[model samples]
Target: MIQVRIKPGVEDRIRGFFPWVYRPEIISYSKQPKKGDLVVVRDYSGRFLGYGYINPSTNISIRIVSFNKEEPIGEELIRKRLKDALDYRKRLSLDSNAYRLVHSEGDFLPGLIVDVYGEYAVVEFTTYGMRSFKDWVVKALVELLKPKGIYERVSDYVATIEGVEDKGGILYGDVPEEVTIWEHDLKFLVLVPRGQKTGFFLDQRRARRLIRNFVKPGDECLDLFCHTGGFALNMKRAGAKKVTAVDLSEEALKVGKKNASLNQMSDVEWLEANAFDFLRKMHAEGRRFDLVVIDPPSFAKNKASVPSALRGYKELFFRGLHVTKPGGYLVVYSCSFHIRREHLLQTLLEASKDVKRQVRIVGESIQDLDHPWMLQTPNTLYLKGIYAEVL
Candidate 1:
């Protein structure tokens, strides 16, 4: 293994079990490091830090897998990690048959994502280093879960940034274009090969169940960025009289329609348009909803874009507030790790002050148990939602 030493004062973070090592933080390498090579990361004084794989070309240079000096990165370690991830999932008795089998850093296997949709599993390798262990990951998934088929999904970031040529296909067995899965009495058609984030937003499984508590029969509801209508379907299932589901992706709305039909509840009004534009249009039209959910894609991909993301959130909240009926529920979610909970709260505060709408927070939710967030690595906790009642 190659020995890589970091600059001074950087070891404290590694000691706290922070997984990533930035490119510029390293002082010297024992030898010339390759793009995806197993490295023994060390302190400036040559003390052991952790064992991880290095991507010399990337900004996040090293992603540590094993913090214990004695436990190195090997086939055994890989198998153990996969087993740990599976065991954690088995413990959760969720109503959903589909869930995230492995959540990248959340599962302590950074750069690897596995989302299970019934008999099939979709695997994504986000980093060059984790890509090297693709065979091991597939074999372990087969041995443990014994899924009928395994499909490889290549993200654009992996293709562009990591430069992996494989355009994603069936790695093992046969994976169909669409797979039907159920979540808490609601059935959905998951586009394993083509759908967003392994067919459905499995991270919002908890939110789907929780939103039922706020919904009432004959209540008008709005689901923004309604990818495959996860929340909209849930809202309808909970007996909402009218539900408006909006999204830019016609493909997503198509599947969402199928999902609504699959559940035998086809009343969800699916609209194709940009969510931001739709929110403003609804406010302009004086259309008020009993419950409004603004669950948009990550506005900020990095820290530098956070300011712009906040401005975007402020506007969304302002419009969302106006569109929400007085004494109705308004839920906002931020999927970006860069956009912290405090940022969402502050934006909500500003939006409320500008709109003069008194609001009280009803509840909060994070990613489901299937998507575990490590305390040491704040980045693992990426999904957050705030449920508020407007007065």
Candidate 2:
């Protein structure tokens, strides 16, 4: 195996069990390593650190596979990790058919994501190192779960970030153009072939459940950025009198309508328009809702654009506050890692000031327990939500 030697004093992070080895931490290499090559890492004093897969092109030099000196990184290790992931889902009793089976680093399987929707699963191989083990992993999943279909959703941006041009697609079982799944007693229609991120936002499953608690019978609800209508359906089931769901993607709207129909919910109105534009139009038309839900897509993928993302979030919240009746409830959310709970709350405070509305925060929540956060990695705790009542 190739050897990677760390710079002096940089071995502390490795000893602390951090998975990533940054570029600046490396002092020297015993051999030129290719992408996806198995590498043995050591400290400057020649102490064994860990074993990992090397990616020379990216800033993340090594993604640790094992810290045990005698254990080997092979198909057995992959099978163990995959099995543990499956067991976790089962333990949570997460409706079985539609949920995140594996969440990359959260499950200790760095650079891999597997989302199961009914009898099908969508896999995303984000790094070259993970891509190298794709075939073995797929085989292991097939033997263990025996899902009806498996599909690859890897695309161009994933390749650009990993510094490789290889894009992955359906590698094993056949995946259909569309698939139906269930979440919290509601059936949803998903377009696996073209929908966003494994055909749904499984991370917000718990948050949608929380919305049900706030909705009341005969309440008018608005679900903004209602991709696939998860929140809308939940609100309707919670006894909301009517639901208006808005999104920019016509494809998403189509799925949203179908999902509503699948649940035998006919009181939902699906609108194919930009959420920001639709909110402004609703305000102009003197339309107000008893409960407003704002769950927009992540505006900033990194720190550089966090300010602009905050501005977008502020604008949405400001508009939602305006269209909400006095004493009505508002549920706002931000999925950007750069936007923390503090920043999100502060942004909403500023929005309230600008809109000249007084609001009382009634509740706050984050992603479900399924998406566990590493103690050292705060970025994994990305979702922030607030439930406020207009005053």
Candidate 3:
């Protein structure tokens, strides 16, 4: 293994359990390192910090997997981490069988994600080093969960960044294109091979269940950027007389409609169009809803995109507020790590000031319990939703 020394004062963060070491933080290396090489990181004084894998080409050059000097990075260690992650999920006792089993850094497995939908598991290896442990990961999951199948879903960007091929599809056993999973007694069709972020947004499981509280019988509801009608069906199931779901992808809308029917939910209007445009049109047409949820996809992928992401949030907040009836509920969410909880709250405050609506925040939601976050890595806490009453 290569010995990597960090610049002075950088070891304190690693000591604090922060897993990432940027390229510029390296002071010296015992040898020229290759991409995805196992390394022992050390402080300036030659004190061992952790064991990690190095990717010389990426800005985030190293992702620490084992912080204890006694523990080394290997198949056994990976299996142990997977077991721990699985144990944590088992303790969560999530209402739904579909959940995030391993949340990358949250599970101390820096570059892997595992989501379970019913009897099947979906995996994504976001880094080259993690992909190298594919056999170990799959074996551990199978032994622990006895999942009927395991599917691999790799992103093109991650593939390019890690210099790995995109081998996205079934990795083990038989995987159906669509699988029905139950959440809070409601059945949803999860498109494992095709849906976004492992079929459904399992992180929003709690928020989807929480939305029912704000809805009243015969209330009109709008679910913007509603992928697969997670919120729309819940609102209808809660007795909303009418619910409108809008999204950019017709495919998602098609699935959303199917989900509505699966739950025996009626009067849900699925609209395939840009949510921003749809919101603007609704506002222009003097449309208003008793409840509205604006759950857009991650707008800021990195720190540099934060400003534009906030602007996008502000626009959606404004439109969502404008179309929300007085005393109605409006929920807005940001899935970007760059967009913090404070950013979403501040944007809502600013939007209320401009829209001239007195808003009272009623609730705030983070990613569901299954997607556990770490204090050392704030980025692990990504999804945030603010539910407010427009007065």
The global Cα lDDT (0 to 1) of model 1 is 0.92
* RMSD, every candidate, angstroms: 1.1, 1.5, 1.0
Model 3, 223-332: lDDT tens digits are: 99998999999899899999999999888999988888787778999898999999899999999999999999999999999999999989999998999999999998
TM-score of each: 0.98, 0.96, 0.98
The predicted structure with the larger TM-score, 1 or 2, is 1
Please give the clash total of every predicted structure, in order.
Answer: 0, 0, 0
Candidate order by TM-score, decreasing, is 3, 1, 2
lDDT values for all models: 0.92, 0.86, 0.92
Over 4 Å off, model 2:
none
Candidate 1 lDDT tens digits, 296-340: 999999999999999999999999999999999999999999999
lDDT score, candidate 1, position 287: 95
Candidate 2, 11: how far from true, in Å? Answer: 1.9
> Which candidate order results from sorting by lDDT in descending order?
3, 1, 2
Given candidate 1, what's the lDDT at residue 332?
96
User: For model 2, what is the C-alpha lDDT against the true structure?
Assistant: 0.86
Q: Which pairs clash in model 1?
A: none
